[model samples]
Target: MSFESEESKKLGGIKLSTLTQRLAYAGIKEQKAALSRKATDNNIKQIQAAIMLQFGKLPAPAKIWANVRHKDFTRQVRNFMWKSIHSAHRIGTFWKHIPECEDRGICQFCNEPEDLEHIVLKCRRPGQKEIWALAKELWLKKHPSWPVLSLGSILGCGLTTFRNNNGQPLVGASRLYRILISESLFMIWKIRNNSVIKREGAAVPAHEIHNKWLYAINLRLNFDRALTNHAKFGKQNSIKTPLVLQTWSSTLMEEDKLPENWIRAPRVLVGTEQQSSHHPSPPPGRRGRNR
Candidate 1:
């Protein structure tokens, strides 16, 4: 039985279903196009100024918006960055007008107005500090020094550039920085939300926080490795094996012991200096049994 009304289907020689689908697609396309125009808001201006202060070059507002959709970012992290740049998260003053919800706008730990910056950067939450510390330790392996991380710098991490004394671009280091910054920021926000909503403001333990951060990093490492398969992601989309190696070279567990091409290596973990000493990394294609 046909569900479409004959009159509706014949109106423009197109079925009602097809017309509805076209209209819906057009609406979605319009919304996406609006994002570029929205880039002129104060939030983007602040990010532009922050990027300029940190990198010594002002990226256009459009570039900042484009960076939020960087191909390297996972879909969830990309959306979070987009919301952050738009200041769309219901934090800080979003609850000010709600009846009897004023306290929801304040951070219980710091007793200050709550916002994305406070959650990710300024809050003294256990997870916030430990996550960043772990990220810095990992980054220090890739570069000699770490950049001064501000809210703006963190958001504009996609535009971050790394260079050697010869003024050559360090592509691996830049990619690593973007991944670490975006993941750490998202982790902090998760911890904060869990504390405020689920645990009723209880603090997560420091050790647990560190473990969570490492897990997130290792998960990304595994995802990167999976994306390197030409059969899966194709040449254009797949991350080059060398780039992956360079991105994670110094940070893997028993990195020196691992083979040169370890893309297919099993149980490849990102480990700290202390942790690396306890667990030896296996060479590529070695399937060993543990007693």
Candidate 2:
């Protein structure tokens, strides 16, 4: 039977069923129209902005559905935004291992809704400051002019490429910035979990976290060096240049003071001689340095 006929029969002369069906359909139609109108208005505003800046403009209706034709651009924008907002998933199996908080189902470290923001930015656990400080340093290295606020803003800006006043792309140093941002956040989350779950009440030291970050940075720099060397010499067997290695190694050791044993390593002897003699050694007559 036709829908109209079925509705009429169900109403039994009152037509209540038909009326209800019509009302529901009308409500859906109105909602669609309202959303279309809102999109149309937004497009108009964007067009106006473009026209004022003499960059050409899209018609209101066309702009509203531009994603249909410009699928790649739309998808790239969507993915970039998604990654910027959700960068905490970089560490292998870190989030997966986070047990639900007993009280509010939150991650025990960050304690703010148990999501990316909480774990990286809002976590109040000890030694969290080091992760935040490292993140800030990375940001400043990439964007000297950017204002440092919460970790979320830092990651967002790092992941996104913005146009300057002159329409230049003010992005991070490289595409690898996304990976670095994710790794840093994941490292913080892992350290927090390790301290809370395995170590009981013992906190992960900030210096340890910094060392891990430096190691990751050094590994990436070395990989880059190897790739560049291979490209330049057209041979994988060719060793990386001492100059490039020296530059990267110095950068890795910039903030870290290596132990006496590390300082005396064969590789260290070939590099810079500016190594710090102070390696967290015990006080003159004391056992180990106080915790």
Candidate 3:
């Protein structure tokens, strides 16, 4: 079919760029506007100060912000992100603001406010700190140059800014990074909720959390393989440099059937192009000496 509109022909099909990055929680602007209106009576510079102090200056409204959460996550994961961002969860602090709720608004594990931030970032509850430490250890393997996370980054780590050594942007890395961050966030929340609401023992140990994350990754890899009908028989590991491998190389290198890929072919490294034709021998002294 021929083009029906001149605008379609005027420029090759390309979506307009976004200069704003609003989270667009259901009634966020109305909430912020309400805060502004209330600020005159009370010293609440609500919209500007709260967001800036907590999450740095908000970026211009960008679809990528929402895309990163929704596209990369299942329905439950998306729901979790939305609820946390909008402060609509059933945490005690939310109930505390009510005029006559029975909630004390303090963490059972640690005697502090039970707000989401306190739970995710400041809770020194036994297992919580260890889980974050383990996450930090894995995150460092992919981004060693990055520094410690601030309070905002810990809470909204899925949207944390990411780059590599030499300030080079790691293309396509954010999706995997978001997965890593989101998975850990959800896991922590699950552990805490189970303990408090369900009376299901204490928060899980860090080692268990680590293993659970690995299992989740492996399950995802297997699903990707099945979805794409990738054959197992191959001379090369297709997932060697794949994003999962790149992000979790420190741990995945030791795994046997990792990073299953749809394209089952040998991925050649750039510098190893000549190595296929040329095999190198270790200098003679070390090999002979061991023998």
Per-model TM-score on C-alpha atoms: 0.79, 0.43, 0.57
Ranking by TM-score: 1, 3, 2
What is the per-residue lDDT of model 3 for residues 1-291, given as tens digits with 9 covering 90 to 100? 965665543322322232223433424566756744453222112223433554476532243245436545656777776566556676755566577763556786787778777776678764455455555545554554433444344434444445566766564455555665566677778777767766644655544554555555545545433334335634343333355444434433323443343234343111101112134533433221111
Q: Report the Cα lDDT for residue 34, model 1.
A: 74
For all candidates in order, the CA lDDT equals 0.80, 0.45, 0.50
For model 1, give the 10-residue run with minimal summed lDDT. Answer: 282-291
> What are the per-residue Cα lDDT tens digits for candidate 2 across 1-291?
555654555433345545676776777678766755664454345334433333233234343233222221223344433443333233322344356524334545544455444555666775455655554455444444423344433333222334457977533232334435445555666676788678874776645666766565545455545544565667644434543333333223332464432322333321112213344522343421122
Report the CA-based lDDT of candidate 3 relative to the real structure. Answer: 0.50
Across residues 1-291, which tens digit of lDDT does each residue of candidate 1 receive?
Answer: 878668866534555556777776776677656753474376677778888887689999889988989877889999999988877788886688789999999998999999877888889867777687778878877787877788888888888888889989898898899899999999888888788888899987665666677888888999899989989889898888899998888778887888899999877888653233334533433321211
Candidate 3: which stretches are off by over 4 Å?
Answer: 1-58, 61-70, 97-101, 154-161, 165-167, 200-210, 221-250, 253-291
Candidate 1 stretches with Cα past 4 Å from truth are 1-40, 273-291
Backbone clashes for every candidate come to: 0, 1, 8
Clashing pairs in model 2, backbone N/Cα/C closer than 3 A: 110-123
